[model samples]
Target: MSTIESRETSAISGDAGLSLIELIIYILLSSLLLSAMAVVLVNSWSTQKDVASVTQATNRGQVIGSAIERAMRNALDFDVDDATGTELRVRTSLGGNLACQAFLLKDGDARFTTSSGALPTLASDWARWENGIAQYASTPFFVENGDVVTYTFDIETDSAPVRFSGEAAARSTATGVSSPCW
Candidate 1:
């Protein structure tokens, strides 16, 4: 074969495939890129999970806070128990005989119970943190100054603890009304 033709053929063959070292380098680079992508994916998932947890905690706090505020605003008379200072007794305007008690259960469940008779039935679970992992960091309490009442509480979750506080004004006209507390 001619020298020029032989040289061209050799060059083409040499360039046809990667050497062992080049192949190893390529594989290393590809693995690094995949690893980076995997790290980014894991970080993104972690961030999303944190955001969802915070949002859920905030929603629960808002729901419970709003309910307590609404009930307090429509209440005739409300008192925080002197014994534990965690139990709030409220006489609601729904009826002169209707009364509600808000307290934290032994297992950290915040509950609301209404009674007009001998037995006080569980009306609702205001905040349920009874699974042990999640719980009420602080039981709800009320600070009453004349007609204005302030409520404050905290709920602990996996991500963080959520705090809630609000002020409500009792119905002035409903004052001095009698309600049954069982």
Candidate 2:
């Protein structure tokens, strides 16, 4: 009878704490949720980075291209040895009295030469060339004297490519001498 009474008392007692198995299961579920969230966050970050790089590269490329175009359009003097061939000399205005010259060369590839002390600065994801042709970072800006100036900006990073080649066109003091060659 006493044993029966003790058993009844034990059964009546409510559960006070979680069992080891329950605790373990809870921990595992929480860990799994956290891990999944981490993965999602990492993936988002990676995609964002890629997008940023591409944008930067493109902007850089545009700047270099625009600079070349402006120079070509503003050229006070120009010389085209042969239209069939890709070599020309152009003279244009620089900052203030400083004159800027550029030579364009377009063969199978393209390159350019500039008078600027520093090369063109693209958006921010490409390389700048002091001389010689580089891989087409951006489209060819212009062609003169077998030299090509191409500007490329990085799409994914903050780097740009400004490519210069050969010697810039010679600047002439003559303001309005309408000659075939300046």
Give each model a TM-score: 0.79, 0.50
lDDT of 1: 0.63
Count of clashing residue pairs in every prediction: 0, 36
lDDT on C-alpha atoms for all candidate structures: 0.63, 0.47
TM-score of 1: 0.79
- 32-92 per-residue lDDT for model 1 (tens digits): 9999999999999988888887777778767766766777777766766556555566777
Model 1: how far is 100 from its true place, Å? 3.6
Please tell me which predicted candidate would have the highest lDDT against the true structure: 1
Candidate 1 at 142: error in angstroms?
A: 2.8
Considering every candidate listed, which one attains the maximal TM-score? 1
Off by over 4 Å in 1: 95-107, 118-140
